[model samples]
Target chain A: MSLLEFLDYSGVAVFAATGALAASRKELDLIGFLFLAAVTGIGGGTLRDLILGQAPVFWVMRPTYVVVCVAMGVLVFFTAHLFESRYRLLVWLDAIGLSAYCVMGAAKGLAATASPTVAIVTGTMTAAFGGILRDILANEPSVLLRPEIYVTAALSGAALFTLSSEMGAPLWLASLAGAILAFGVRGGALAFGWTFPPYKARPGRHPDDVM
Target chain B: MSLLEFLDYSGVAVFAATGALAASRKELDLIGFLFLAAVTGIGGGTLRDLILGQAPVFWVMRPTYVVVCVAMGVLVFFTAHLFESRYRLLVWLDAIGLSAYCVMGAAKGLAATASPTVAIVTGTMTAAFGGILRDILANEPSVLLRPEIYVTAALSGAALFTLSSEMGAPLWLASLAGAILAFGVRGGALAFGWTFPPYKARPGRHPDDVM
Candidate 1:
């Protein structure tokens, strides 16, 4: 398989494992594990495809994605207890997946002739939306609501990838640069508990007045 | 515009209003209200188009849908406090929109030559997924978890629409029957607090063992 294709599938598998781990935390059944895994594996790509007007979503075109996700789900279900800290693994794997997906999504957006801004948006969405859906489905507070700079990391990577693509960099080279930036930022955050400045409440601002 | 077009736009407007109402409850700013409104107005149709491999989602092609949603958002922002019980209006408007969306989605599915079961599923998704997205984004307890039989109502309407279409019923006739069924069921639930039987939790079923 090509590098892009391999990275895409690895991302799917890793995300599926994270989803299964989440299901285990919720004490959900096997069906819940499979459902969450499939949704987490494919949700971002599905949304990106729809927004880009790309017909027959990636997984629908290649059934192997579904098979890989299901396999990951089953594996996680059987071996979740083996890991001493599943949450840590989930975070690290998710960071890797996010980095890879950002580059891939930006590549697809560029190929689709989307404008630079839209391409970056697509990449960010592709990288982060699956996790958003996973959190929502598992009834956890979405990471979006947290102070963590998660979406910002995805956005930066996407912007870098789009810029590199526009500068005529080779696909692999551009993707590599973007992925490194994303992973580095996310990895740093994981290690150091990095976060954005919290939004301070405006004492006199009425909720309706802000509009 | 044709009758279907009219109902579709009406559904979008109503859904957008409901989303704005939700945003008001969250004490979000103006942008949040508009964002939620747009998401609720188009989320279901976007999902349906993606699944059906329909390129360039319905709103992207028409543009009017977004305009309508924004307008509704602005209107709701100004008039949110005029109504003493916004929740009641939200539910009734949501029911109306759900019924209209079901018939419209089913018609599109059948026109795309989807199987009856697929058409029904598409209809149900189109009717309910927008509200699901809205609730998730607003961090509300989703209607899906409520005692009111919302999804079941959508599914029943979609099934009836698909069945009637397969039987060579005219579009108007089939749509009317489907819409009536959906609204009736939803309206009854609203009036009488109807609900499906809760699933009984089985003891001794390990979360991982079911796989």
Candidate 2:
């Protein structure tokens, strides 16, 4: 597989794992855990595709991602008791997925000829929006509105990627650099318990996050 | 306002009311009702915005729609218990909103110079999609996924609008014709208990819906 494709799979796997972990927190059974994981992992991309006027969505078009997520979900279900820590592993995986998906989305946006600003927004949004949707569907507050720096981290990485492209950086270099930056920002948030202030909080949590 | 805008607002009002009623079924508070109402009312439009690459979203841009939905939600919260028959009210309002939004979406797609097939799809999607998202959030099976004529009705209206537009019908007439068709189809389903047959029932109920 190409590097980009490989990274995409990695991102999906990590995100799915984190989703399963979250589902386990809800005391969900194996299938429930897998179901949530797949839904959370794919929710953002589905929204992105629908909005971009792309037909069938990525996961819908390529059902293999579905298979992978379900498989991962099944494994996590049977062995959920193994990872009973307070989200440390899941947090790390989430960071990796966030960075990886950010790079992939930003690269894809630029390839689609989006303007620099739009590209960054599209990329970062693609990276973080699905988790936000999943949280809302699961009746949890979105990480986006929590001042938790999730979107900010994605944004910073997206900006760096775009800037690197403008500076004539190669795809590999740009992606690697941007992913690191995203990981750093999000990692910092996880390690230090960083969050934005509450001025931007939506009423009773996110309104459009459900959509 | 022109008749078109009048129709649009009316559709929004009806859809919003239906959303509030749905929330009432769960015994959610006023704010929750508003959240659900606003989403069900404008969710399709928001989806359309993303597809059209319209930024910040309509409710975000206008803000009034949010106010309207919130106000309607408050109204429903107080009056919901007073209604002896909520089922009929929600269903009919849903029908009206679905019809109006379907035609409106088609018109927007046409105005954007989108391809005819795309326009038809966009129109129908714009009308019904928000409800689909709402159902997911509400932990219910999407009406679209069922053997219901919901999406099919939207498709029918969208096709009508596309054909009328191609034949050079005036915008008002075309939209009216299309919307009436959609309303008729949906109304027929509600009256006659229409449903889509299951595609093999999928072994067992996917336990995810239980949550």
Candidate 3:
């Protein structure tokens, strides 16, 4: 398989594993785990394809992505308890998937729409939206609402990759750089508890008056 | 405008209003209201079109739907306090949108795929998914997990429309019947507090052993 394709599949598997771990925390049945895994694995890509008008979305076209997700769900179901901290594992696995998916999504967006702005937006969305869906479904606090630098990391990777490709960098080099940068940012956040400042209401104005 | 087009726009407007009400409860700004309104209004049809392989999506092609949603957001932002019970209004408006959209979605599904089964499923999804997206984004409890007969109402309308149309009924008659049935079921639930039974675990099998 091509490097890009390999990264795409790996991202799917890792994201699916994180989703299954969430189901384990919820104490859901096997079907719930499989459902969450599939949705979390493919949700972002599906939204990207819909927005970009890519018919018969990637999972519908290949089916192997879903197979990988289900396999991960089943595997995680039996072995989740073996991990000392499932939440920690979930975070790290999600970081890997986010790093891989951001670059892959950017590449697909560039190829499909040939618009750098769209590429960057789609790339960030592709990396983050699956987790958003997973959290919503599992009734967990969304990563988007957390003060962490999760989406910022994805956005940085996408922007960097898009800029590098536009500057005539080799595809492989751009992809590797983007992935590493994303992972590094996320790792920093996890290890050091890095966070963005929360939004603050103006001192004198009413909350409803901001609009 | 044709009847179907009228219903479709009404559905968008009503659903958008519901979304704006959700934002109001959260004390969000104007931008948040607009974002939630737009997503809740168009999310379901977008999903249906994507699954049916309709390119460019409905809102992307027409743009009027989004305009309507923005208008609703602005209106609701200024006037939400007028209502004594915003939640009650939101539920009623949602029911109206659900009834109209279920029939319209089924018609589109039937026209696009010419398969009754796909029509039924797509119709139910189209009616229900927008609300699901709205709840998730607003951090509210999803209607899907509730015992209330929300999805079943949508499903009944979709199934009724598909069945009637397939039986050589006139388009207008089938659409009206289907919509009324959906509204009736939802109204009954609202007025009488009707709900479906929750799933029961087996006497001895553990939750994890269900698989």
Q: For model 3, which pairs clash?
A: none
- Identify the runs in model 3 with alpha carbons over 4 angstroms from their true place: A1-43, A55-128, A137-139, A144-211, B145-148, B194-211
Q: A1-211, model 3: which lDDT tens digit per residue? A: 8778888998899999999999999999999999999999998888878777986789999999999999999999999999999999999999998998999889988887677766776787688888888998898987755555787788789889999999999988889899999999988989998875433333443333310
Error of 3 at A25 (Å): 11
DockQ of 1: 0.12
Which window of ten consecutive residues has the lowest lDDT sum in model 2 chain A? A26-35
What DockQ does each listed candidate score? 0.12, 0.05, 0.11
Q: Per-model TM-score of chain A alone?
A: 0.93, 0.86, 0.94
lDDT of each: 0.81, 0.73, 0.85
Off by over 4 Å in 1: A1-10, A13-17, A20-43, A46-89, A110-124, A136-140, A144-211, B1-3, B9-39, B50-93, B114-121, B136-140, B144-211
Q: For residue B109, what is the lDDT in candidate 1?
A: 87
Which lDDT tens digits does candidate 2 get at residues B1-211?
A: 7756766777677788888888887778777898899988888888776665565777788888888888888888888888778877877788888898888788777676546755775686678776666676567645543344576677788889889989999888888899899999988988896654322212333323211
Per-candidate TM vs. native? 0.61, 0.55, 0.61
The worst-scoring run of ten residues by lDDT in candidate 3 chain B lies at B26-35
Please report the TM-score between candidate 1 and the true structure: 0.61
Which lDDT tens digits does candidate 1 get at residues B147-205?
77899889888888889888998877888898899999999999898888977557876
Looking at model 3, residue A127 earns an lDDT score of 89
